[model samples]
Target chain A: MLRNISVEINGKRILDNVSFEPNRGINVILGPNGSGKTTLLRVIIGMVKKTEGKVSLKGKISYVPAEFFSAQMKVSDVMLAGSRIELNEYTKVMKKMEIQGLINRDFSTLSSGEKRLVLIVKSLVEGDVVLMDEPLGNLDLANRAKVLRILKEYDKTFIITSHEIEVLDFASKVLLLKNGKVLYSGNPADVNESLLSELYNVKLRRGKDGWSNFRFDF
Target chain B: MKGINLIFLSLLIISFFLSLVYGQVYVPFDKIFSLHGVYKTVILDIKFPTTLSTLLIGICLSISGAIMQLLLRNPLMDPYISGTASGGAFGAVLAYYLLAFNLPFSWIIYISPVIAFMFSLIATGLTVLIGRKTGVYGIIVGGVVISYIFSSLITVMITEMSIRFPQVPPLIFWLLGSIQIVGYTDVVILSLLALGLVLVSLRYSRKIDLVSISDEMAYSKRIDPNKFRVFWIALVSVIVGYVVSQVGIIGFIGIIVPHILRRFYGGNTKSLILGSITLGSTILLFSNLIADGSLGFEIPITAITSLIASPIIIYVLVRRNAQEY
Candidate 1:
């Protein structure tokens, strides 16, 4: 939960007066690039110092960075980092993620999507509250769906930031942010085309699957 | 022990005995322990301390090197990369200068390591302060700059000394690194100190692993990255200062042993430090064997290590870059 969270770095405000109470499900933060989405996540986990704010989260928190600089360690070693899980528990988690065979492989040699999944599994096993930054960034369509499915059934607090609007379909609560200000904080279904259009600075239409950027006017 | 570690240990044992037997006077294996007079003096008094000091220094530098890499978050980093060796060398050279010219602080020659230790801390502290704002690359650049400045100053002082006292041999040979001149008292003291530092470092291995990932990761794990960085860096400076004060800057052993063994031993700090103990000593003992007038004259130990390490470092760099593509 965040209240009056504002972050200013080098005399430039990165996050203005922002606030939201996230529930025990996927609370998706929708925003354009540099709209302070990542900064908001970092502030919550105390990675970026909030200029002024009240951040209160009840539970252990783990973070999956947007770009994981994989250490020259094994996948299993990376997974068990800062976690009290046993090898069998790690194996079970890895099995669920379909990365059991990669337990012995060098983490650096894994593909980007595999690495992202590994970190996700790591965060999931390590914390009751997981803050993921662009977790679906490097994942392919199938892996994205796989990850989203796993997250939806995990029964924990997930504060995920994504530029991809498709995740909007699964979000229990949505916080629409534009230029560091929260424009909407309610049900995901309440997020409309016009507000999203304003948020991205372009005219958009909601298609059967998700929102799409169209240039028919041009 | 693992395969690599066992191999290294065996190599160390072999090299240890060989060094004892093949010094200035070839006291064969039979005479090394049982003989009296010159053979006993050479093996027990002269060669034992020299070889023991060399082994101890290797362990200290190698562990320090691995810790330096973790603290800096740069695999290429070594104990000397932060200017400690050059700073310690500067202090040693200054001590010699003062003694040679009967300067005000001429008595410092008796307790030169204290001066060297102080200078080493100052140099590394300056590097840390200069680079604190800019992160990894800044610290590396700052270290290089500090190292160069101290090295230049040492060269100037040595040059002046050479001009004034041409009959005395130059300190350049020692600066290049040699274990041939260490006495029993220094060896015993260094062994105890190095042993304590190594044990302390091993205890922090798990924390070092977490910190090496990233500061945010370290913070998430409830470990303060900045605090650990300072503690480890200070510890490494002490290790380097002691080694340099006793035997000058050995060079490359710190970088080379860790860089090489990390392949066979893996990147876990505990295992790497453990493996480094054996392998680092093995490499140095062999180098000392070749440098200890075995081929009729002495060679600086750094020369041998540089000859071995430079190519391996280049190969690793090239291979890493190639892998990235």
Candidate 2:
């Protein structure tokens, strides 16, 4: 939960008096590029200093950063670098993800989606409240589905940020952001076509099936 | 314990023995035990201490390199690159003039290592201070500039010293670096200091591993990377200072030993540091052997290290290029 959070970098306000409370389940922050989604996540994790705000977080917080690159290390070593869990527990979690084979592979050898998934797995095993920034970014359709399934099954608080509108389907609560300010925060089911069209600055039509579509044919 | 470490250990041992025997006058291993003359004195008193000094210096430098690399998060970092070696060299040369001129500060000037350590620490402090806001790449560039500044100062002082005392022969050879210990006392002091520092570094190996990757990652994990980096910078400065005070600035061993060992260790700071210890000593011992044996006369140890390590470093850079997209 944040109370009037304001973040400024180099005299430019990146987050302007933002305030929102995440739900107990998966709470997703939906925004387009340059909408300060990553900054808000970083501020929560204490990676970025907030100029003025109060951040109240319960329990241990683990984070999956949007961009990560490591030394030429084994995947197991990368996962266990500063992990809070034991090896057996970590192994069990990896088994649940069905990515046990990835443990022996070099971290740099993995594809982008696999790397993100591995980091997600690392955070899942580590934190009570996991904060992920653009977790589904750069992922293909199949890999995106794989991650969505894992997040759905995991019984924990996840504060996830995404530019893609598809993430709203599984999100219990949604915070709509535009130009570094919160536009709306409530149940995702309450969100409508006009609000998203304003948020993305593109005409989005809510079809009869309750899925949104861009006005353009593409 | 492992294959690579065991191989390096064996090589270190063999080179140790070989360095003892293959000096100016070849004293065979068996002959030294029974001979009770100049040969015995040469092996026991002169060659033995010098060999130990080289080994200790090697340990100091390679460990310094490993620490710098981890602290800066750059694999190419070394004491030489961070201005520590040139700073120590400048301090060592400054001591000569301080004594010759009979300066007011008597205590520190009397001991070269004390003054050398002081200057090296100051150099590192200045480098970090200047580069504080600029990040890692800035610190590296600052170090290079500082190194050149010290090198120029050393040249100016040496020239002034020569002009003042016409009888004094040029100490140009010292700039090239050599294992020139005063006696066994130098070896003993260096051994205790190097061993203690290396042991202390081993205790922080886990912390080093955590902080070496990225500052944000370390901060997220609740490790203070800045504190660790400062501790390591001071540690490397002291190690480099003392080593250079004993043996004039030897290069390449610090950079080469850790780079070669990293292929096997792969981001394991403990294993990389431990391997650097043995591998550094082995490579330096062999360099010392070539310095004393192959040329039929004593040559600067740096000459051989540069010759051998340049190709290895070039190969590493080329391989890195090949692998990158």
Which number leads on TM-score? Answer: 1
Model 2 ranges with Cα > 4 A deviation: A83-85, A206-218, B32-35, B104-115, B118-143, B165-174
User: Looking at model 2, what is the TM-score of chain A?
Assistant: 0.93
> Evaluated on chain B only, what is the TM-score of candidate 1?
0.90
lDDT of 2 by residue, B1-325 (tens): 3887678889999989888888666888887567678877787788888889888888878888877776676656688777888898888777776647655543433467777888888887778776777664677789889988987888888788888755332455446687755458878787897888779877877667656655556666666677778777877777788777667778778788888886777656676678877888888889988887545888888888889778876785675566555
Superposed Cα deviation of residue B44, candidate 2 (Å): 3.4
The 0-to-1 C-alpha lDDT of every candidate, in the order given, reads: 0.79, 0.78
**What C-alpha lDDT, on a 0 to 100 scale, does residue B142 get in candidate 2?**
91
DockQ of 2: 0.40
Q: Each model's DockQ?
A: 0.40, 0.40
Q: What is the TM-score of chain B alone in each candidate?
A: 0.90, 0.89
Deviation of model 1 at B161, angstroms:
3.6
In the predicted model 1, the residue pairs found to clash are none
In model 1, what is the error at residue B203, expressed in angstroms? 2.4
> Residue A2 error for model 2, in Å?
2.4
**In terms of TM-score, how similar is model 2 to the real structure?**
0.88
Candidate 1 displacement at residue B260 in angstroms:
2.2
